[model samples]
Target: MTGTTWDILLLGGASGIGKSRAAARLAAGTDGFIVEFDDVVSAVQAITTAEHHPALHHFDHAPDTARLTNDQVLALQIATAQALEPAVLGVVRNRLTVDTPALIEGDYLTPAAAARAVDDGQAAGRRVRAAFLHEDEPEQIAANYATREPDDGDQTERADVSARYSHWLAQQARTYALPVVPCRPWDTLPARIREAVD
Candidate 1:
């Protein structure tokens, strides 16, 4: 292990808020590895048949939650996020132990949790930054989701949930003093993200 802290950039935000693109740009510039929480959740779900597994109950698992209403699905999504904290933090710890820089991006990486990592002894002498992206209009966010290739459930419902999540994320960012960037049009998101991390 080196005596330097590893560079880990954490991007958190609502769905369809341009976090994916921002992460891609950062990774391209910094040669950083990307660790997405949704991918992590999917990987966990593939190997588990646990009925109580949080990810299994998420709205993304449409087949399983076919009978659930949008509100129920949203509740399950929140629960799954809370349940994944330990796993996400563990991944961060392992990644930071290595020399390579990493960019951990996803909706589940809350500002408070990132702040805990930011203040840890492991982050001393190294850069550990976090940013949250948000879109003011839920309709615009819904439109972004509607544009995705692989269609999921109702875009409007997802957007509504995303809007609520964004507000919550903003509060968390404020509480942790993390940067909250607007990604409405995503015209300058990558640049703004770079500035925030720097």
Candidate 2:
């Protein structure tokens, strides 16, 4: 569904994977609006309590990042994504009935979650495209991070997490038959992303 034909586009990937840029580029290239999935997670957290959304609130207090391992961080992300899957689906279902030309951006909708949305959209005869941007090389992601934030110091740890998370997302995308676009060769990234979701 070339952006124009889709009602909602589910754009997902790990942090620092150019998802934000993809959303902006895609939105600019089409008649679509951007809606951060984090906003939905935040709204749900605001109306709920830790007891109800423990995964979503695990990092509410912003615990020490140094204390956690990469696997641990990945697990937290998976848990949070699991907790927010329903909300994501709810938004997709709601959009199916409305005229919202939105591109939902974030890691909240993992490939599994996005598959559900795609299935629902199919059942309702609505177009909902999903694409995930990934970078297999952690070093490349770190370099991109550096380019995005020239003043920021080394981002080795962050890049490691992002790389690992991106691998997981890519694998899941393959399993679900979803699009997994490369975020490399930065110059052609935007065009590739637009083509992938289209």
Task: List the global CA lDDT of all models.
Answer: 0.73, 0.83
- Estimate the TM-score for candidate 1: 0.81
Clashes of each: 0, 0
**Highest TM-score, which number?**
2
* Candidate 2 per-residue C-alpha lDDT over 1-198 given as tens digits, one digit per residue, 9 for 90 to 100: 243657788989988878888788778856567889888888998998877767677666447866898888777777778778889999889888876578899977789889999999999988888988888988888988899988999998889988999998999999999999988777788777667767
Q: How many backbone clashes does candidate 1 have?
A: 0
Q: Indicate the residue-level lDDT of 78 in model 1.
A: 68
lDDT of 1 by residue, 62-160 (tens): 676647676676676667677677767777777767778888888877776787767752445556777888878888887778777446656776787
Pick out the ten consecutive residues of candidate 2 with the lowest summed lDDT: 1-10
Off by over 4 Å in 2: 1-3, 60-63, 150-152
User: Cα-based RMSD of the predictions, in order?
Assistant: 3.9, 2.3
